[model samples]
Target: MGSLAFFIASLGFLLPLVSNANPLDKRAAALKPFNLRVTFKPAAYAVPSTIQHVQDAVACGASNGVTVTAKSGGHSYGSHGLGGEDGHLIIDMRNFSNVTVDQTAQTANIGPGGRLGNVATALYNQGKQAISHGTCPGVGVGGLTLHGGYGLSSRGRGLTLDNVLEATVVLANSTVVTASTTQNPDLFWALRGAGAAFGVVTNFKFKTFTAPENNIVFQYFFSPSSASQLATALTALQDFTRNSQPPELNMRLFLSSFTTFSGVYYGSRSDFDKIMNPLLSKMGIGSGTVSTNSWLNTLTSFSNGPLAQTGTYDTHETFFSKSLMPEYMSPEAITALSNYWNANARSNSRQWYLLFDCHGGNGSAITKVSADSTSYAHRNATFKMQFYDRVASGNYDPSWMPFLNGWVKSITDAMPSVNFGMYINYADTSLTKDEAHTHYWKDNYKKLVDVKMQYDPKRVFEGPQIVGS
Candidate 1:
């Protein structure tokens, strides 16, 4: 969901299976693997239609000393669903892709395999309701919700995890259990944000909200001729986010060939223009595009629809992405980022760009909740920064990677006072283990570890940077 770009890569060798059925059976091949760019092939892949099948896969993996990795949409940036290495069994949950809505209860039961697009469409058809999810429709609800889903409606509606009322999970021991506010409360709290390490979530029961009838999307492309202009624009953006914060307004900044300011206002176009006028005028944006559309259409516009179905889905291309949750946008940080972009403008791949997502505000329900109430700890963050780049030929270029790494380090080092943290969903394998734990979990790391020990003391669900690993 960070940035949709296709990649071509080779697959790893498959290991023999213990099942009586042939490993190459039609069912096995029919199991859809979403991230083709990930070469971390498991010893076997199973499309489990029922809980029994999931249990059997776990049993097989346990008996053979191979770990079991649950692959829902397979959209994990770090390929956490693909074992993150090799010699594991993959439990593909595509068969479990189902969405059931209870109109009276104002709730929806979504399977882990269900993508955001399908979930949105299903809920919309049910009663014109919706949930907060990422921009990319192909991203699995399991992964997205488990790691704190951010989207166009997040600031107003809260995260996807915040909407989850309950979850059905298959623990490391292959036992099924339900976690919720009153049932397995500790696990419920842990699963909301740091779930990947404890168990495989099979289904999520979410509290739904009435979908907004129309959303106004505004797009502005600025060609700043000087650093002074860029700095002013950045300062205006910061001011707008901090002072004129509107719950309905979701703003994003992109730095590439040109500086682009995009925003989605969950209201009428006239109201959006009224709220954004001061920022627009201050930034000297004479003209821009504003269109009103349905919530589902807005999601499609953001992600380009289902990536798996689209030929543009880069199955072979691999990419590396890193994220930072900056407390606020500082002028020095802005200048440092601009300089980095200018220096690497021509050298970096066209697909590569920087993303700054406006996050917290007074109206934001995200900040209303206590940071310790859920596994997600970045409630005070004003914005999130992402540095994304595509890997050439499924591999990192030695010379280029070092430079890129140093550039990232410089950006973080430049802002020592900023409460910098990282989003686990936008995972970066290049980080050291300690760095990953500190950035991703923060103060929640110890509690998550304790829960991991309780559910999986033997560490069955394991991966790089996974809790208790």
Candidate 2:
């Protein structure tokens, strides 16, 4: 999610996101810190958005072993996960958005805080490809990769972290070092899933693959008022996962108000018809439109379409998730979501939404990455159910948030085991600290805390993960 053009421009500039405007805009003289976005607001809030001569700053912090946490981009719902609690210093990693490819190694070194756009372009330059969820160009790579990335490239390849070969982190001791399978094996194992808790990751080394020579994929949309239609699509993908068929076949079962059945096949047009042509008849879908796209197409174009292509803006968000398998979303979930969105659609004043992080693409690749290895633990799931309702945020209205949130909770309660873990990045402050830990990352949460205690023994890298502050 590296916003390249903008990041490059911010080299000698300051762009603050919070109010009261206190980022130590003026350069630090001795005690003044560089590469650190500090807001000594009601309390000390640190953001790790850049890595400029980090080793020096880290060393300076290490004198007192500088207590600092890291924030990539403000994408995490959990108060920007790395925003340390209780007057803590921070290293904003958002400014480290540089992606470059190594033609020799056939890989790319992407900044932890960079977005997918820059990373993809870097690889594209080297004529290499990396699997990443490119849904939004603005999503920072930190939280996205830290949470087991799944996106348009998922079905063809696998999760984003799967392709990661190495990472450079700034340890609590203010030491910068690299971690990979060959180096720091234990830390490497922990990093794959439990990365955020370890330290401030500066750059990520991703193994690349050959970009599609010229691939064709179709995106099918439906406004079905019921579940049977959505289920038919979900079950079909489940079948694909159960049987690892041709390498060319990849299917995604997306569940927003406008459920999308998007798939990518390596083959050309003829190859698409051979497989998908049958789905049109099998699914019994009507009132739906279809469109095929190429690499030139934009994601916003694929998502929401004209109906919602305009996209809704969010002042702030509180994301929630409960275990929801394909079975859950089908028939019942679809109906619920349809009614939910329709209600919101009718309201001219409200902007409520439900974004489905469609989870599928077989299990082996992800399951292979041990469940305990990282903070992400939803291995058994085909899709991670997500709720994205825009609440009245500006004026701090408590009116609709609680009600819509409650309704989503009821639907989630129907299927608990399916409730895997809530995403730390999509966290909502409304949820209790325990709730955020248990719902999103589960056992991995404890492991992360342990890692925090070990690396940042002083509790310097605290974020929303800490309970009761």
Candidate 3:
């Protein structure tokens, strides 16, 4: 019999004391949330894999009084921090990354620890594709949808979480169970946005959307880009959304010294005219070109294939929408944006990118599922904010960390949104309490904490970036 079987057989005796039970002590358990060091190691716990065998290592870790921190590709910017910066019971989840697509059902069971490239290719084998953040192929969907994944297709499909139907979670006690509306509904509601906070998700079942046999898309570059003009362009695209437009079109505005507009529509060469004609004529931009290619080809263009032979990189993101709530930006708010970007990216290294993923495909799709239905509370809002800054450690000069530290200080000094809640997945581990509480949706945090206490009262499941971690 499995461990789950054993757990079920003994439930009668364990039921009375489940919640009030003491958590394995942080000092004695041989593992803790995070202690913070540059090169994080699991000081007391770590487990490797062979093919797909994580059980032995997990057992070994358990026998030694350590909890396993499962890792897929370890793609997160600060994923290593989970082991208290050195408590090493990391479980690599990549070997189990195989994806299977059921075309008739238009559903996919993707390994939580698997990268999308692997999953997407597997789905292609069966003639299907999911509404996912397809921009970065290596990002784990586990982490992506857990924090509401956004992508090139988001403008038409809504964030990836909207399309999810189920998730298989490995709870604190190491029991694997399925979460969906029909079963363990509270956990289902919690998994949408708070998956990282709830537990380790083993796999996710997503409702797949049909992929075009051919795709028509284009990328336009702008000159003399000013922030005001960029903002205008972006807000205008939001206005362009409607019931028509093939429901397959996605538009997103890019910013920087340059502005790039990218769109993907599922139609023939002729459809490009109907799509671009409106935006170009309305925006009044003089020179931009359009190209047609297969959907896969266009996706390749977005990901920007393999880098130099020797490649190792880290990514960090923050999302704040001064666009919504309170209807304005205070001086402090602007100061925060400017300081964070300058400190984390432009002037410093190891941070790069600012991405805004508008909830598309009728954001109402997610709203239909109750506010308390999922940990994702911003469903009522039309779009999710994204900020990306890509920088490599080797690129920074002497005082980079100082600048970053100062930048973070400046941003926190200002107030931005009604929802102090920042997206859990994109936030820096050190985010202030207010930011976490309101950045996503107000009044949602306390409820999340309640859910936290209910599921893992002892808090055996550790989360560094989430509240009460």
Candidate 2 whole-model C-alpha lDDT, 0 to 1: 0.54
Query: Model 1 over residues 31-104: C-alpha lDDT tens digits?
Result: 32333444575666666677866766665566566676787777887788787777667777766778888988
The models' CA-based lDDT, in order, is 0.74, 0.54, 0.54
TM-score of each candidate structure, all chains considered together? 0.88, 0.74, 0.72
- For every model shown, the clashing-pair count is 7, 33, 38
Taking every candidate in turn, the Cα RMSD to the unseen true structure, in Å, is: 6.2, 7.6, 9.0
In model 1, what lDDT does residue 199 have?
Answer: 80
- Which digits, one per residue and each the tens of the lDDT, describe model 3 over residues 1-469? 2443233224322122222434343222222221112235453332222322343444444545554466554544445324324554565454456578888899988877666665666666677565556577766667777767766666556667878889877665556678898988777877777666666666788888776557777777654234344444544444554222345666555644355666676666676786677776565455666677765666676776631111222333221212231222344554465545543444333443444444432432443456665677665544444444333323323233344345434544575233433455554434454555555445566777887787666555454445346
Sort all candidates by lDDT, best to worst.
Answer: 1, 2, 3
- Cα deviation of 396, candidate 1, in Å: 4.6
Q: 1 or 2: which has the higher lDDT?
A: 1
Error in Å for residue 312 of model 3: 11
Q: In terms of lDDT, which candidate is strongest?
A: 1
Q: After superposition, how far is residue 147 of candidate 1 from its true place, in Å?
A: 0.5
Taking the tens digit of each residue's C-alpha lDDT, what string does model 2 give over 263-382?
566677786777666665565544444455544343444433221211211223333222333423444554554454455433425444444444543433554455665556665455
- Candidate 1 residue 89 C-alpha distance from true site, Å: 1.7
**Candidate 3 ranges with C-alpha deviation above 4 Å:** 1-38, 44-68, 80-84, 129-131, 225-228, 238-247, 268-272, 281-284, 306-353, 360-370, 380-383, 392-417, 440-442
Evaluated at residue 153, the lDDT of candidate 3 is 67
